[model samples]
Target: MNLHETTVVLVAAKTATLAFGSALTYLSYSAFRRTDSRALRALTIGIALLTLGVLLGGVLHQFADITLEASVSVQSVFTAVGFAVMTYSLFVDIIDEPDRTRSGARTGD
Candidate 1:
């Protein structure tokens, strides 16, 4: 494909990524609000960071005229940090639900 075609495809892919990331972030935030769980809050933040990485990377590369390598580096850092938070959210017992079991079954409601 030519340069124009490649650019179009890249932009389209980035747009789709942004849309899906935004939806995921919204859903995560809603869940966090409903449950008031610290883990959920962390998850929401992680998702938001991941989405921001995509946006910033695209904008830096396309609009700011930054090098592709620099943009990708920025994106990678965000992605790594986001995944770390997400992993922490999964492994740490940030919730204070005393009635909840290890199997995730609520002992009382």
Candidate 2:
């Protein structure tokens, strides 16, 4: 196939990917509400941000005024923020679990 056709195919694939990502983000948010877990809240934020990053990275570079490098940089930053949030969520959960386990045992659980 031609390069343009290939690019179109790739863009289609990305659109599908973003749609799936958005669904996951929605699921995370729903899970957060039911559980009220801080970790799940952070995870929801992370997924939302990461999906936004992916959207920006895919679309912003198409404009003539925006440089590809600048779009990539912004995308990288957003993705990094998402990952940082998720890492904090994981750490918070990890720290709480052991403490809860120990406390429960001591409290005669």
Instruction: Mark the 10 consecutive residues where model 1 has the least summed lDDT.
Output: 91-100
Residues 63-89, model 2: lDDT tens digits = 645786887788799999999998888
Identify the runs in model 1 with alpha carbons over 4 angstroms from their true place.
94-101, 104-109
Predicted model with the maximum TM-score: 1
TM-score of every candidate: 0.84, 0.77
Encode model 1's per-residue lDDT on 21-86: one tens digit a residue.
Answer: 999999999999999988888899898899999999998998999999999999989999999999
Q: Distance (Å) between predicted and true CA of 17, model 2?
A: 2.7
